[model samples]
Target: MKRLVITLMLIFSSIIFSQSNYEILPIKQHLNDIYIIRMLEGENIGLYSIIDSKGNLLTQTDNILISVQKNHIYLVTKDYKEGLMTTDGKWIAKIGEYNFKEKYSNMYKEAENNSEKEFFIVYINEMPRHKYGYINYKGELQIPIIYDEAENFSEGLAAVKLNNKWGYIDTEGNVKIGFNFDEAYDFKNDLALVRIDDTSFYIDKNGQKKLMKSLFREGKEKIENLGYHIGSAFEGKLKIKEKTN
Candidate 1:
């Protein structure tokens, strides 16, 4: 009886031990190779320099925090916000915070023809009405922030909401695409996925809807969440999952 109890306890302990899980993803800077890192335990996660494919933690655990693009986990942020930070720890932008929505919709103006326009979030001191505009990446309010909301730039265009309508605008702040569309998404690759009424369609870089789904750029591939989503197209492969007996 004593032997049976001890055996069961040992088996349970072994099962728990084997279930302990962690993930390591590869990192890179442009064509330069960085280190692989992962977020573990709590809010604090740093990119460790251990190069073993098995994710060994080495001496330089102070490098990068990762975001998986494909199988390669690119360094996107190191801050607790886990927002984007340069190697020198500068705030470039926060991922997933670029979208602008209201009680109505997520819309914007089109990019101006043959012009350079940028996306911006207009900060207002009071409620509603035209106010100061701020640009993303490029820090110049070329266009006044007269609109209620605005979003980031993709494929040289952004979506802005004004007078309770949506329109597309070039980075130059010109109304290349008028205030239209009930809702829209930032461009990925070369197409922006948009939803108007009850229909969803893919728009080209020029903001023209592509009726043929095949002609449309394939949907942006989601990196494996098990390991991490690396930046850029996946070069390395990682299978992040639990081992089943």
Candidate 2:
């Protein structure tokens, strides 16, 4: 009986040792059967590979892997060009001009769930002068690189800067809100906060004032919770006696 127990313990140890050899990465970045795996033991530890459901090697490439979307694989070539590939290792399309954001990291893992816009933001030229624009999933430029500053789309609108003024634009690049504000922010709950000259207030989708007594009271309560009065919270941008109709 003692011998049998010792033998069973040895077998269990062996099973654990073998199972610890590899690590299955995040599933959101992979298809149903395809997965990104990394070696956790032996000399090849830390090495990554693309494998099938049955652990069969699919294909190997030195290009930096970005993310998988639908049937296409996004990758960055050795020469810094961004492109796509098939699951069976065939080239789809390569674009050289725009450098994709997070080229070396895992990007777009949950992009499908977090965004409604099909376009992603990209920048051109160097810092302090990098013009911003949007691109489709197929590496096609949708919006021209013209904005001095840009933010991601929220509720079908993105806040962008032009001629040193901020405004909102739709996914089609049409100015939804006129460029007249000194600062702007993304929309949330059908309202966006904007500032003109020294006054800060909230606006609706049509660029109309949306500050009601309820919103003002809510802001005051939140500011007080943070140990700040509403007058100081807006830094003189909000008037103390501003009537809310």
Candidate 3:
């Protein structure tokens, strides 16, 4: 049991970014390079790269930004504006209308798996009204650009905010579970951990609580079958105690 748990943990860590029904977001720069984000604990945008570039890394931005397909780097201004530059310090995609006065932005520091013949750097747009969304490898809005907040993909589902509440959404941008929780976690064993009224519980992708079926459906049947007398608790516990029909 311990070994099984350890294996699952390792798999989860490996594909933490491969969100949704085990969907793998395949992105690579070239034949032998794998684009990956290696952010160490404590740093905001730590070590974004295409594996080992043989010291030919394209380091161009101050705040985690990269476009492997275009081979460009972007820097955001102190007041939340984007500035684009190349790996060797050349202006390619300049920051202007879209970046000016933008409240939310999603920045990509490096590609994933380094196989992306095409890629994009996202801006969170963190604005309450904007709530920036994600883009596909083709730079298309796979998910609607509208959301209060969006999390990384996990198990083909993502935590999205709508109407000031949170819920889960499939890759098609359809709501799977009702968005009415104070907090939510990734899916595990086909169940998602949700918090309600100071209590934490697990619910299936369909929003059914795991223990609900057993507690409500089976608890009563089991009680009746036992003749409504749960005497097992006292059985053999006391020296003089005896059980009767």
lDDT of 2 by residue, 162-221 (tens): 989999999889999999999999999888988889678889999998769347956886
lDDT of 3 by residue, 1-245 (tens): 99999999998875564222121124333223323343343334353332223323233223344443335443454344565444444444445423422122323333433331222324444544555465554335566667766665567777777776778988777889988887778876687777766656678888888897435545666678686355654454553454332
Kindly give the number of clashing pairs for every candidate: 28, 0, 28
Model 3 scores a TM of 0.43
lDDT of each candidate versus the true structure = 0.48, 0.70, 0.52
Model 1 lDDT, residue 59, Cα? 24
lDDT of 2 at 239: 55
Can you write out model 1's per-residue Cα lDDT over 85-144, one digit (the tens) per residue? 233233344443222221111112221232322333545444645443544443344566
Q: Candidate 3: misplaced stretches above 4 Å?
A: 1-130, 212-245
Best by TM-score: 2
Question: If the candidates were sorted by their lDDT against the true structure, best first, what order would they fall in?
Answer: 2, 3, 1
- Candidate 2 lDDT at 229 equals 60
